[model samples]
Target chain A: MPAHSFRLLSLGIGIVKLLRSSDWLIVPGVLLLAFFFVAPTVEIALSSIFDEGLTGKHFERFATKGAYVEVFRRTLVRSVWIGILCVLIGYPIAYFIVHRSLRTQVFLMLLILVPLWTSILIRTYAWMVVLGREGIVNNALIWLGLIDKPLRMMFTTGAVYVAMIQILLPIAVIACYSAMTEIDRTLPRAAKVLGASPWKAFRHVFLPLSLEGALTSFVIVFMLSMGFFITPALVGGRKDAMLANVIAHNVEQLNWGFASALALLLLVATIIVIVVVRLLANRFVGVRSVGMAP
Target chain B: MSRKMGNPGSILLTAYTVAAIVFLFFPILIVIPMSFSGERFLGFPPKTLGLRWYMNYFSDANWIELTLRSLRVGLGSSILASVLGTLTALALARSQIPFKKAITALFAAPVVVPTVIIALGVFIFAVRSRINDSELTLIAAHATIALPFVVMIVGAAARQVDPTYEKAARVLGAGPVKAFYYTTFRALMPAVISAAIFSFFVSFDELIIALFVMSENHTLPIRIWSDLRFELDPTIAAISTLLIVFTTAAMIVADRLRRRSARKPDA
Candidate 1:
């Protein structure tokens, strides 16, 4: 009995060793992230509170500031708007692609992806041309004898939305398209065959199935929008400032404590929103796999 | 199916889609022609057509210097990222390791987190650690950002190849390392190459983080950013056209590789 127990202990040790050896292959990547990624992130979060010792002064200052709170609220609301706009602009396009012939689908997909791979800075710059005072749109409008003065198109809220939507629409389209493709075509056909009109079949069967993907796109776009700094800074007026622009402004000023505090709060808020929305969505719609592409 | 193809609904959908595609691609490609404008500021119909902006970009010493620096940084960081990311992906393939889900999520977190937040955090770390503005610092910082892309692309590609090839190599008396090198690594080469190209652009195209961390090591994007804001030069349009071609070519290769792998049915 004693000999058998000793043999079992050695066997357990051998199994553990085998598993860990394979797992050990992941160490280099893990360590790289831990040191560079995790450490810096933890540093930022802890620095929010650390401030040369234990202190809640940064959070305290934030709690009292209405301006900071206003910025946060504006960020959230603007992001939600951007997300909804992307869905509206992208849905029909995505639905159209899914119904096309295979060759046309691939060709159209490449068209979307070309801009995706290109730099956002370039895209943003391109918008500056199209929407500038003396640019193409103004040129066309003037040629048509619509107005004498070029529209104050640049550096406006509408400019921000237009550029933001253009940048994000492809993402929403791809997300919705992938999910829409996975939906069994037979389900909608069955509804039509069972005395339902085409519109009714689509409304009841297809809409519910595709709603999950559109919602997923909305959530993703909103999450990305909340952190947008460049587009808002370049194209938006001072009032269109997002939370990320605030962080960049603070960092430039070398206000580490406040910037850290703002970053930590934004990170926590984003994670919480994602978790809560996902949970609520799962409960109402049932779990469905959604793919996000940008 | 035949009847459905000729319906009014389908026609309208096709029309709308074609229109949307035009909207999406128009602004992107217009820059190509705009790059040839002889005007100083952005204008659609030029008084003259020439390669003046392209000449300006080529002639300027600062532009040449900045381009070289960007190319160097992109190559350095991509080599680092692809090697490390591919290794990690190889290990992660067929992984039943404890906490694998948590580990994968951690690897993927960089993409989800906002660039501003990461840049801020990393800037704070650099300042505290007394790391100065240098190529090494930029490479490390950019590698961190690009690592997730490499891991996702290569890792997904690696999983498609069968493990039995490695076993077959072993049965034929090859050593473990040699077996993996010959079989799994060979299978993963296309993905690894694409991942490296993707990583290069990831470093090259980065702006916000480079804005924060870089000092004298001004990347092409940083140079373009300052120029766009301060000068409003059409030289940027020429540079942008060049960049678009490079990036589009890289993306085309990646897409072809992905489609080929998927359609191959076996590796």
Candidate 2:
């Protein structure tokens, strides 16, 4: 046979082999994931368990230490609160963008995305500048004669809330906006045709469809908040430390075992929350609508 | 009907949205003048206007070094991530892969999980492997962070590509490799480029892991953190303004490119 024919034969064989294989394409991807992601997580988990023969000291420390418990609780509370705040703050913006004319939606979308273009560090710095005692808000208030003295804002839980909500609100808005867009306008109109009031129509026909996207948005914000370190570290008071901050502290202090344990626990807790949130949202809000992209 | 008179909820919703936008964006907009301020402090409403701080950042050796280091890490990680991610996406999407959902979830987990936890895991593994916080280690870690995003974007792009062309080419006696390169690869280029641009931004904007992992070999964010920790400086404001311009331009261009390519009938 000619070389060309031989090449053709080999190509056909390769194709046959490829078709016969279960997941040849995923081999590279799976290997990469195993190496880069799954392996590291496994290592962290294994290290936490086996400092030397599978001791439970790391987990015990977390359970026994008041500091760890406080940090964990504070982290959960702060993250949940921030997630809620973002949802509360983001829902209206999402509603506006969804209901607006097409041209207006484009412009507002840019406004929403422009902040995301800037680095999170720069944005956080801007917050520091704005909320600092000698910063813009104080100066503006003083100039306007609102108070005799500057209000203490920086390094407070308020600062953390403000900065975090700012940082994560865009995500919530985008998520909710996309969700809201999926809702059929006719559903509300149908309710109106049935003698329901406009607001009642929206409340019954529209809100339920959007709830999944809103809940998913809330979960995303909460997940991201669980990992937040810089914003809280920079803005929050010393007592406002989150799990990420504590993990960073351990990593910095060379306590690898302890840090790994804390990280694993955080991961497990995040997974549980995500699952629980999904279940709850599905039960109440009807999660099938989430698949409908706005 | 008196419904319009009675229902003030729409008005309230509009007000809340405006307040939310202001709260989210007011600080970002306020920094423009702060960067231009000729004051010794970072106080709002500059006492005077001058380009001294911009000049200071441009001339400062430390800032220059940090910028270069970030560029090296960002660009390196971006290339590594885009290449590997595109390839993996192709393999996963186009290949006859069983457990496709599971594979996709594995790729996506890194993005969903807290970066702080990933950073800790990477930190421990690096320590064990004796890979200190050198530039190379940082790049590898960043590539890991960026990989998932690249996979997602590129995979979506790949789904839009017509597999019939590759099949046709193969029928025309083209080898599988040759057919893929000639037919499928060209179609995937726009997505590849967009994913590369996004991967670069991901590495460039990333800070959490950089903070925990690269303590000594400081990236720009770490430098800014340390500077802020010590004292107030207007130089950071100046640097941030420059970054904002670069990022905005890049995103706009990428968006345009995406739109142009998507509008292509052949695509």
Specify the highest-DockQ model's number: 1
Candidate 2 wrong stretches, greater than 4 Å: A1-16, A19-28, A286-294, B1-12, B169-182, B258-267
Best by lDDT: 1
Worst 10 residues of 2 chain B by lDDT: B1-10
Each model's lDDT: 0.83, 0.82
Candidate 2 has a TM-score of 0.90
What TM-score, computed on C-alpha atoms, does each candidate reach?
A: 0.93, 0.90
- lDDT (Cα, tens digit) per residue for candidate 1, span B113-159: 88778888778788778774677777877888889988988887877
Off by over 4 Å in 1: A1-21, A286-294, B1-3, B262-264
Q: What is the TM-score of chain B in candidate 1?
A: 0.94
- The RMSD (Cα, Å) of candidate 1 is 3.8
Highest TM-score among the candidates is held by which one? 1
